[model samples]
Target: MHAKADQRIRVTLTLNGRERSGYAEPRTQLCDFLRHELGATGTHVGCEHGVCGACTVRVDGRASRSCLMLAVQAEGRRLDTVESLAGEEGLSDLQQAFRRHHALQCGFCTAGILMSCEEFLSRVADPSEALVRDMLSGHLCRCTGYTGMVQAVLEVARSRRLATGPDSQQENNDV
Candidate 1:
């Protein structure tokens, strides 16, 4: 016998460094599960087909489009949403840069863009302006015109490189 189409499955994953479990239909999108089941509303849903990049989240340390993934597919994986970026003290460096640069206007796309940038900065310690722009091309923001975002990302890159030095390991997400 096969599972019914409406059958719900228990999906367990490490979310924001904490183990989380929720029940959802196997066909439910990861974004929906995160928002409705886990109460992680920061992961937005836009252009569910995945072109808009508004549903971006970190899956096992890489930026992934949650809208493109099924909730069941995320079981047993480590996932990080925008809520994971900040600490008890304050916002992360990347978030501070965005705020200082006025990189967000309406803020609908900010969460996903921030998640993507967090993953990018972790891998590229000293990113150039062109590369930063390239990485941001995947996201879509109706406001802020992308200039402030580019500047913010570059500033964070410079800060991370200066803090860790060129030869040192890449910046950590907590920084």
Candidate 2:
């Protein structure tokens, strides 16, 4: 039999610091491949049209909507999802902030929000409430009324700033 390309395409990428490969149809969304193929269910699938932000993930250090991208598009890229948020120490700083603030209700949108916040916090060590809101505009959370989320993100940012030292400019800027 002659070797020929089939409908399935092999995709290889770095997932949560680990190398992984999976085959998928060219039309398969990255969100689907992550969940069904790789078992990374932390990447939720909400609006397939990329409106709800539930499928948000970090591709190559930037926030991206997995549903909007095909699985093949993720080839050779580093992808970060909500699954990588936790460590041996337990909940990450952002997750701890969310838990302490009770920022989630149904929890459907928590993963995407956390991923977005993680990427934002990594880039912006100090963020004002306005800045946080602007950063979170893409995410849509029906639960917690958004106040708790804002508070949680602000707390994380403040704690990060405090960790830098007592003289951090972001100190006393608590939301």
Candidate 3:
């Protein structure tokens, strides 16, 4: 009989608007791959079993728990981490809104929360307070209650609507 050997899988994905390629074991979690292999430590790993949303990231514009997905499973997918929300021009609308609204505390859960909020706002521009609460139920934050986060999301939605007019709601759906 032959002995079992470690398997390395190659994956290519778009990360933070750039193309990234790497090789990892089939069992390697996406969170580890992003933080260790790719050095994208912005994706935190609070709970490895998907209980906490600290490892949240956008996979094809959908918020997903990186700890639950294998690195190989993200092959040929588009991934966006917290780092992508900022640039030379400064923070994106979501990042700015989080900061302006004081939605973060201890900063441990900020990245994941922002990622989830980004996804949520993209899907529903003007989400109700109840909807915001329900959407954020998947995440856990020990520092701040859901009040600040929900308010930040709503603020961003309102700003987008005001800046682009009511028709701007359609733009968020494409994200």
Candidate 4:
């Protein structure tokens, strides 16, 4: 009898603050690896061509398209999906802001939008409407006109500033 060979490659990475190790095909997309393998389904897979940005996630604090990246590429890196935004207490401030501003309609694009907004807000504490629009341009939301999404992010920014004061400004500047 012929011996079977292992075709999957070993991939190890930190996902949502937890170290995860798994075997995946070298060509497996990170989105599939996260959802199918690790079961992090919050990272939605929409266009798959990197145009829709619905598979957006944070890799080492930078926004990235999970569908456009391979699972092996995330080796030794820190990855954060939409699920990480919420803690044990409840939804995150950004999530709350999204709800308060009615950012989501059908909710198909909420995960990616939130991830992108989180990245943008981390960099610009108080971004202008135009900036917010530009930053979110990559994401496609068929439900809302994106005005609500922008407003939601802005609301979070305002709240951060009001609650943290100048420290928030300094933190945003540092990014």
TM-score of each: 0.94, 0.90, 0.93, 0.92
Candidates in descending TM-score order: 1, 3, 4, 2
Taking the candidates one at a time, how many backbone clashes does each contain? 0, 0, 0, 0
Candidate 1 vs candidate 4, TM-score winner: 1
- Per residue, candidate 3 scores C-alpha lDDT tens digits across 1-175 of 2222377777789999899988788788999999888999988999799988999999999999999998888999999999988889999888887777778878998899888888887788678999999989999998888788888898888887788788556545645
Whose TM-score is higher: candidate 1's or candidate 2's?
Answer: 1
Q: Could you say which candidate leads in TM-score?
A: 1
Residue-wise C-alpha lDDT for candidate 1, range 10-33, written one tens digit per residue: 999999999999998978999999
Error of 1 at 32 (Å): 0.2
> What's the lDDT for all of these models?
0.91, 0.87, 0.86, 0.87
Candidate 4 lDDT over 33-52, as tens digits, reads 99999988998899899999
- Residue 73, candidate 2: C-alpha displacement in angstroms: 0.4
TM-score, candidate 4, is 0.92
lDDT of 1: 0.91
Alpha-carbon runs more than 4 Å astray in model 3: 1-5
Better of 1 and 4 by lDDT: 1
By how many angstroms RMSD does model 4 differ from the true structure?
Answer: 3.6
Poorest stretch of ten by lDDT in candidate 1: 166-175
